[model samples]
Target chain A: METVDTLIIVFAVIAVVGSAAGAFLYDPPASPKDFVVTFTEEEHDVASEESGSVSGSTISDTVDVPVPMPNVTALELTVTMSPSNSPPVRANPANAVIIVKDPAGSEVGRKTITWASTESGAKSVDFDIAQQYLAGLPDSVDTRNLTAEEAETWAAGEFTNRTATGIWRVTVQISNPGTVPNEETFAISVSGTATHYHGQARLETGPISGAA
Target chain B: MVKTQAAMGTPEGERGAWSSRTGFILAAVGSAVGLGNIWRFPFSAAEGGGAAFIFIYLVLLLLIGLPIMFAELAIGRKARLNPIGSFRKLTEGNRLWVGAGVLFVGVSLFIISWYSVIAGWVMRYAFGSVVGSYFDDPAGYFTDVQTGMDALGYHIVVMVLTASALAIGVSKGIERVATIMMPILFTLAVFIAVYVGFLSGSGEGYSFMFAPDFSEVDGSTVRSAAGQALFSLSLGQGAILTYASYLDKKESLTTNGTIISIADTGVAILGGLMVLPALAAFGLLTGENAQGGAGALFIGLANAFSNMGIAGYFVGTAFFVSLFFAAFTSAISLLEVSVSFVVDQWNVPRKKAALLMGLIAYSGGIIAAVDGEIMGFMSGSWTDAILILGALLISIFVGYVMKDAIDELDRGGIRGVGRITIAMTRTVVPIILIVLLVLAIKVEIVDQYFASIDLFGW
Candidate 1:
């Protein structure tokens, strides 16, 4: 009986050790492949005429910027209205305006980005621009230069909007610069929304000129 | 001849005196020094207010933990019974008072099921560290090896080892194991602390650990400190009660309790020295995403070992091996609580009681191991809640119910300083513990008040 007890004890120890090994060895299955959106920037020169149209011109311009997206995922494009060259304006109750549309040119989602500051003086604001907002834009949209029509769409979308994909144009018209100085230097920041296959989301942000 | 005869028959009252004073101290210290000292204490310190937490913890240890520990030992020695039996015997066969002992066993068994699983993780990591499996790709290796069947298996191995040791009974088993293991545990802890202290660019980790980030102090920090004081000393659990049952009346409970508390706290501080410095030395402390969970010791230390070159392998192995011993000793105490109860109460043979209790613990442990959430709740929230409640209950029993017997035990001990300390322990300690219990309940309010202050840059 003693020997049997000893043997059982030894077997129990081995079984415990074996199970630990199994736990360490187990791995979850890999996720399935899915389409991903990636952002890239290409610079284009704007004709002088495209820069002058304020509220009704159809001119388009191109701007060069670095791509922030590292992986491919679905895309979301948004347009904001803010003052020219101002410190990045937050979508707040005072001056918050955003418009988003889907690929079929239908409004999908819209919200105001609120500006908040931390004790350390760090500031952040969020706004949503739908994928459909990219539809109905001219074949070539120069983010560097904005026309009156684009500006109106940017403002109107700040309240209402549409959706499209491929190349989308965003225009910013700052209404108030707040306590921050150098309002003209502030450019509208554009970002893309994409969800990777692994359930991680990617976002890209860049400055867009407010020349129009 | 005396040793052999004593071993042959378990004497009801005096059969279990430790072979030496050092054996008792080390055994008690072994119970006190555990994963709580190494991982949990430092995390609490870091989260609570670093240096501020240390100060509060030290105060709590002196004010609350030491007295309750002394009371527990005195009760056990006087009754010459296991926690349940001791309480019943002390209350003159009052059955209701046995709840304190029962609660200790329940909490201990619950703790052992999961604690052994962690011990198994340490065992696996000890081997893996030697092989440099983690050295090649530490993060990926930890993530891969950390969960599932491997963890469960190792937990069971350690649990059975603990149970087998307890089955041999106290003198021949617990005393002998503690004597051999405690020195090794201390040596490794000190060696790691010294080695990590001297590493280049380790100043930050050292400062983070020892320099006291005073900013972390607040009311919640104090409550956590008090809770840790209870845990680090193994106060509320009947382990002390059971261990003290083996003590001869001649032993000084106050002196022993102080020594154990100091040794436990010393090792805990050293463990922080070992972990924080190594982490800081490697600059692995950055990026919030890199912060790990309770398994941080296994994952973090593995990552550190992989980076330490060849020396890292040996040191890492030594650290885990020491941890295995430390954990094994405590695990034995936990298993003994239930097994001893069964043997003492049911009149079952020692070996049979061990097997039954071991089987029950093993099954419960398996369930906990598979479900991380359950394991977490048992170890984290449940253990704290139960320990605090247990400590308060034990205090009331010893302070009021056994006050006269306890006073006589305290008075019979050695000379001048010891006598004064005992008087203070009997009177002052109980009052302070009651206050601590009340303060602990309002800890949330204190935490918010402290958070509003900008001290220590927290």
Candidate 2:
């Protein structure tokens, strides 16, 4: 209704037209290139087996796990164990160690687990393999803004011994067999980011006995 | 029934007024309905107990949002000036009240600066939809797009767009754009909701949205609902007040405010329909995957979009385009508050004010884009605290300090609700806002600050 309103409205319309003209007149920045980076989640499980007679004080076995992706964002290993077959054995007080190696046979992750002697029945422990490896690296970088190439390099350095695209080896061992022969049944579950793999871990080596 | 009131008369000295009631409603509604209505509301409802959250949100909207909305419109229309000028006039030059007005401008700047950064991400997503940039690895794409030089570029683009609108003036720039964009936003929202409704597994999402499990309700749920009610309506920051300043007194703030609230809430419900159904269809509505907030919308919904084959492109584009429209309009309103402050308080020309404020806000957002911590602080709990404080101060001013709010509320077609509304504003609104203010401080500010510092190793 006022003179200022009418003039400003006219000016605004002109501005809008000018902006539209500018947008069309000048070339806009190109959109980022389309990238395909699919991440997959898979779990690998090893069947339950009894910790048989220990030649020394440890029982060891290895499982093969397939990782078909080049970049691994996360990896975890979970173990559940209980006293096997022996009805009278209420507690399994043994220490468990897990070691994972890439296709190149270099150790990438290792974790040791132990249970209290008084603990009874089934117990479980989860080890974040990727997190452990990542944590061990120097905390000098903020991963949020890393370029894809930089992220790749950073990831590669942390997981130099942990390739994601191969049949990896995982070794599980039980030690501290004590005089009673603990006789524990354990299952190991491994999970990580990969693509297009049969998500399972198969036993590659037996329950081998080792001298203390 | 909606006749112009001759007694109040048009304020000749006012900068501008909406061309019509419909234009005013559209601009106001455009300000109210934004990303909060889309992504925030559904997640908040789901996390706060679905239907239960909606119920509390509606209640609080009536108790908290509506009164504040009415008060702001009343103050703006009464004084017919920018926020600071309005308070300066209404309070008869009370320095304390004028500073509250200044706080509104400051909060608006803070809100727009960080908001433009986020809206820039939406703009990128909208563009990316055309080329399928984020289709393959939506999660990774989100992380990349939200930071680095790319984010800053988009943020600047958003600020430039908003500044252009403001430089044009109220009726031509904001009202005109909102008139065109609001309908488009509503249509796209409806189209997506109806499209998602036809999906086979969408019933799970509908149930998750509609089925009220009150068992999940808690104090935090109430607090969230209250916060959402305030945030969704764009109350407490003088955007509504500034918009209302450009409104002719013949238009009823009551009817207009109610319509804006209902429209905003409707869009929020529609947003839930679109997002939840799509998530359910993709089997992502439950368990750890059913995360709330930005991650769920950008990453989880992007994953769903990727799985939809060729159709996903069109749908995702429409969705993000609508999101951009919503964010763009709100950004315009927010930037207007500061621009209007500069123009009215400092005697600056409208074009210069818009550019100056826009440039300042844009500079603020550059840091927000590169460093997310500053963005989080500016846009997150601190913003919430300031908004709550603003609303509390407005309620006190309108109901107690200002003598003529009831007269302004009584102006135009609607009448007779002023006494009761004023009574509630004086009594219930302040009490509710006080509670919300304390809750906002405790939950959003103090708790978050302590948590960030890892106080007590929490």
Candidate 3:
């Protein structure tokens, strides 16, 4: 009987220890690291191109010049054209043709902007292209006035390959078609930033220049 | 097989007998329904798989948990000893088989030590709710009371109370207390559940709880449900074994186990209804730390109460009181196991055993409660490790070494449906327990598997 009692006592001790050990096996440590991330937004500037003065005279005098602008990295550009609010009546293409050129004079990216009227009583157009194509463009030749045929050729180039940025030009021809005061050609530079995953470039234009 | 009529002596003049079948069931249910039901179950369900987890947990409780509970009870009754001596007798005095019972008692004591600390927190919260101290800053109130000397003081107070109950012996003290407390617990839970149901926009909370999200069903969820089922049933620990020792031979062990398991599972389900819906109604169900640890329940309920205004205070007090009762009853069982060891083995008087056990538990609990890190380690890592290993040993002893006696004890008294349950309890249940015991040891898999569930907003 004493042996039995001694055995029971031993068993009780073992039982307590065994249960503690078993429970420890199931309870693991909690993680100490935090694995959450947060993001915030910041402000920046937009890129644009500058056109030089049109020095030619007479109805047939035509000058082909490239606009100057900063190098854009990865950006989608859009351009729109409508009769200027302060303009004499002018007949022109309702859409603006956008062309991007690399420093090596190769066509990299291009798009056409269509005019749409918003509730603010303003007609505007826009185009979207990858910022990478704009980043390769030359610093000079931001905007130019193009003839109808040139716009068609630019459209073909837009579909084929990207334009390099050495000398890029956009041309807008204004014709007095309606019974209104006549005016010379009008030039406007579309401005925006070229943004990429790595960074972005800000481009600004000089003032708009015109030709008669 | 040599059958010996071994009279494992109790302390002189001590009558530690269960009064009736009702007494045994109520006491067992008291041990079974605890923080595991209110504090653990809803959070587990929310973290496991919402409604799908509830479904799987219920099935596992009925299938795996119920039968094992019956087997544990039957073994205890047959041996008529504490867990340590029961296994020894079941194995016809094989010393190795006694390891399972020893492990169980150790785990129970460890659990009792820290469990008292938590019970103290409940008591403190109960008081705070009455005085409106929690309303000012509920979260801060919980943090302040849950750590440091205040927690230690309450833990000692609760531990002493539990020891006192056990010292009065089983039938008159533990059973009688449970008889009164269990109904109040159930009634309080049901009342809270119904009251929460009437609150506006409670329908959404109900839908979230009852509506099954089939997408969440996976192997990890199933395993967690299984673990919760076993834990909530109070299996493997000698609580049931100790309770069963007082049971009369004429009682149908199978029938009693089924009834107790059903009652325990019912309380757990009602507890989920009480908590989860309230959490949903209050929109406190989201957040990374929303469903981990005991703090989750306090935080969630406090948030719910603050939103509900003055009525929240009365309801909160009632809830914590019920929680206190549930925890108090379970703690009594834990201390009783230690007392039984002293009385059965050393012929120590019940009162003396209770005093010794109480002192030891109080000291351990004070160490835990004063140091937050120690309390976490005791409750988290220590409890899990001991329980899993102890359960494994118990499963092996019941399934393999003492199969004959287990079968014999399962056969007598139970009839009709009870007899069928006995057959399943003897064979199928033991096999499932063995499998779970093995799976629980693959610690990496279990941890990674449970971690992968996106339930805690992870």
Off by over 4 Å in 1: A1-212, B1-15, B144-146, B213-215, B287-293, B403-412, B415-458
lDDT of 3 by residue, B1-458 (tens): 42222344444346378888888889999999888888777667766667888889888877777666766776778777788877776776676667677777777887898889899999998887786676655544564576565676687689778878888888878889899999998899899989988887667656655667768787767767888877887876788888888788888777788888889878877887777777677655544224545645665576577678898888888888998999999999887887787777656667777777776676566656655556665776334435545555555555555555445455555445444545565576666666665555444344534656554352
Candidate 3, superposed: residue stretches over 4 Å from native: A1-212, B1-15, B288-292, B403-413, B416-431, B444-458
- Model 3 lDDT, full chain set: 0.61
Q: What TM-score does candidate 1 get on C-alpha atoms? A: 0.66
- Candidate whose TM-score is highest: 2
Better of 1 and 2 by TM-score: 2
What 10-residue stretch in candidate 1 chain B is worst by lDDT?
B1-10
Poorest lDDT segment (10 consecutive residues) of candidate 2 chain A: A197-206
Give the whole-model CA lDDT for all candidates, comma-separated.
0.61, 0.72, 0.61
Residues B1-458, model 2: lDDT tens digits: 21122222422332566888888899989999899887788878888788988999999999888888888889988877778888888877889998999999988988898899899999999999888888866655665677556777788799989999988878888989999999998898889888888877888888877789899999889888888888888989999999998888778888888899899899999989889999899776643235456666776777677778887898899999999999999999999998887667655567777777777787667666765445556666657778888988888998899987788888874677677679988899888778878777767777867656644343
Q: What fraction of the genuine interface contacts, i.e. the true contacts, does candidate 1 reproduce?
A: 0.09
Model 3 residue B29 CA deviation (Å) reads 0.5
| Per-residue C-alpha lDDT of model 1 across residues B74-189, encoded as one tens digit per residue | 77777666778777777766767877777888888888877787778778878887887667544344433434566666766777688777777677778889999999999988
